[model samples]
Target: EQKAVLVTGCSSGIGLRLAVLLAQDAKKRYHVTATMRDLRKKDKLEQAAGDALNKTLSIQRLDVCSDESVAECLNNMKDRRVDVLVNNAGVGQIGPIESLSMQDMQKVFETNFFGAVRMIKAVLPDMKKRKSGHIVTMSSVMGLQGIVFNDVYAASKFAMEGFCESLAVQLLKFNVNVSLIEPGPVNTEFEMKLMEEVGKSQFPGADAETVRYFKEVYLPASHEIFTTLGQSPDTVAKATMQVIGMRLPRLRYQTNALYTPLVALKYADESGSLSVRTFYNLLFNFGPLFHLSMNLIKCITCNCFRRGAVSPS
Candidate 1:
């Protein structure tokens, strides 16, 4: 019996790739419902899905922020059966918190945090009743380790981390699995757009020095980080597929191997000085090595957080 997999935000990026990859599964183990907020934006996904369209894969309209839309989409599914729910729909907030609007920040949380919760709530009962299901969410490296100028976006993901971590425990009794896929600097159009906005944003409420630090110091480092460590959407999709294929998927799976040591900073010290100080130093210290920052980042993280040999798997 092919598993019924439903993925949201499938119009582009990792979501699009994941839906198409599952539909094209050689074993024919999945029937996929790919969804987006608007059908008008679906041409890209349709083109990508190719042979799988309307055969193993179907597209539908779903607004994760709207309860009614979530209900209607699931209701329309055959047997209302979804064996795996991939909550990949999210919006990002950038710039300093002081410069960003209250409205924009709320919008980020609504879509990134509450929006995902809405989908989970919509599907959980059915999953619990069946005693077989997987809930996969798209998280970020920021969700595990905070980044400067990405405060609100990181907070929203942090909310997801906490919410799912707590919920996963209860869902275990019902045989439901909750998995978080944390990727660092994914090479997606979404990120490209964010970088463009960062370059052009006026950052009205922030002082000139703060804006300078943001645009001068952080932006270059960000570009270097992306150039060095970014994972393509297809790679991210493959990692997600691997998790789904696992007989017992882990609660947290990070897709970027390069980010593992950096993330380890959080656990390396009880006082939190190691992680914070290391990042603070890196933020200002590596201007000359900006083009080859992978070396700099690796050196710092490895020195601070390396404890044991990482498994090849």
Candidate 2:
């Protein structure tokens, strides 16, 4: 029997690409259910799915934030047999914490943290009863290491990383698997939407100098890093496909090679200050040098990155 894979947040970006890729698999290995909060936004996925629609691929309405929606969607599935569950639904927030409202922080958790928990809760019981399943979550590099100005988002992912790490241990006994895909910088609508929102965001409690630094210094540096180093959503999707294919998928997988060194900084030192200082210098002390280094790295590894994305296995 073909594996039943349910991917959330499939209206766009990594979710959409992964759903289509799995559905269009040459070997007919998977039957994919691509879900999103709003079915009306599914035109892009429908267009991309092409002939696979209602055959290998099906679209469903699922809001990860709502327990009723999640339960209802799973109930509607044939036997609710989710061999694999990909938690891709998430929201992003960027700005100073002092300026951000408590509601803003809660909103990010609502979609990024609690959302994944809701999906896992809705599916894990049946997975355990069957004695097999894969829980794949779309995490971020920030989950491993925090970035300046992305405090709340990083915290949310960190919570997820910890949650998954703890859960994986127990799930091992049941022959179930858990994996976290930690992509560095992916060029997706998620990034674009956050960037646009940041432009209009008001820093209520933050001082003018701090606000100016964020807008002038941080945003430009961030833009350069993303432009020079960001991978496409398809790259992320390909990585996800590879993880799904593994007999025993890794607990944590980072999608970008260029970012491997950055994440390694956390483990390379026992003091923890090494990672903190490195990021501080990159943001404040070596802005120009940092951009130059990223460009050079991109030039040197562009071909390798492209090849990995094309043939993820």
Candidate 3:
């Protein structure tokens, strides 16, 4: 049977790739409802879906931030039967928290935290009543451990992680599986958006020293980290697919092996200063040595060329 799979934020990035992958599954395992905020943005997704556009994949309009939109989306579905719900819709925020606007910070929470909450609320009733379903959330490495300037954004994900952790236990009794896909940097337009934000945004309230550090130091180092550790959206999509296929999908799946150590540092110490100090050293003192260490991590991760974990296989 082809499971009814509904994936949000399918206009681009990981969502689009995952929708296409499931719809084009060799075994015809999924009937995909690929949704975005507006129908006007459907062209890229439609073009990519090709022959599967209607046959296995259908596009819908869904704005996760609105209650009416969420209700309408679920109402539009046939019998509202969604066998798998992939919460992939999210927005990014960067720069110093001090300079960030109130509306901007709220928008991050609205879209990233509450957005996923809204979707899960819409689907959980049916999933629980039916006693079966898979709920997958596209989380981030920041969710595991907060990052330097990503305070607000990381808090949003941290909220999600907490929400899911608490819900997963109850859902298990209902035979509903919950999983979080935590990927490190990915080579997506997400990075482009961040770079654009940097170019256009003026950190008005931030001190001059902090602004200089963000622009002159953090930006370069961030780019280097992304270049070194970023995975492709397709890679992440495949990881989602694998997680979905698991007989018992884990509560958290970290997609990039190179990032494993970064997250590991947090748990390596109970005082919690280990990860914080490590990030400070990496960001403030970033240089070729950082690059060399990154490359060394990439090399050491491979156990004779065949090592894996939270793998996108």
> What's the CA error at residue 156 for candidate 3, in Å?
0.6
Alpha-carbon error at 1 in model 3, in Å?
1.7
The residue-by-residue lDDT of candidate 2 on 1-313, one tens digit each, is 8999999999999999999999999999999999999999999999999999999999999999999999889988999999999999998888888999999899999999999999999899999999999999999999999998999999999999999999999999999999999998989998889888987888889999889878987888888889988889999999899999889887998888877677777999978999999888888888778788677767766554443222365
Tens digit per residue, CA lDDT, model 3, 169-211: 9999999999999998999999899889879988898999999
Candidate whose TM-score is highest: 3
Model 2 TM-score relative to the real fold? 0.95
Candidate 1 lDDT over residue span 1-313, tens digit each: 9999999999889999999999999999999999999999999999998999999999999999999999899988999899999999987767777788899889999999999999999889899999999999999888888988889999999999999999999999999999998888888888777877776778888999888888888888887788787879998998898888777888898776678887888988868889888788778786676565677666665565433322223
* Global Cα lDDT for candidate 1: 0.87
Candidate 3 whole-model C-alpha lDDT, 0 to 1: 0.90
Per-candidate local distance difference test: 0.87, 0.91, 0.90
* Worst 10-residue lDDT window, candidate 3: 301-310
User: Each candidate's TM vs. the true structure?
Assistant: 0.94, 0.95, 0.97
Residue 71 C-alpha lDDT in model 1: 88
Compute the lDDT of residue 1 as modeled in candidate 3.
79
| 126: Cα error in model 1, Å | 0.8
Q: Highest lDDT: give the candidate number.
A: 2
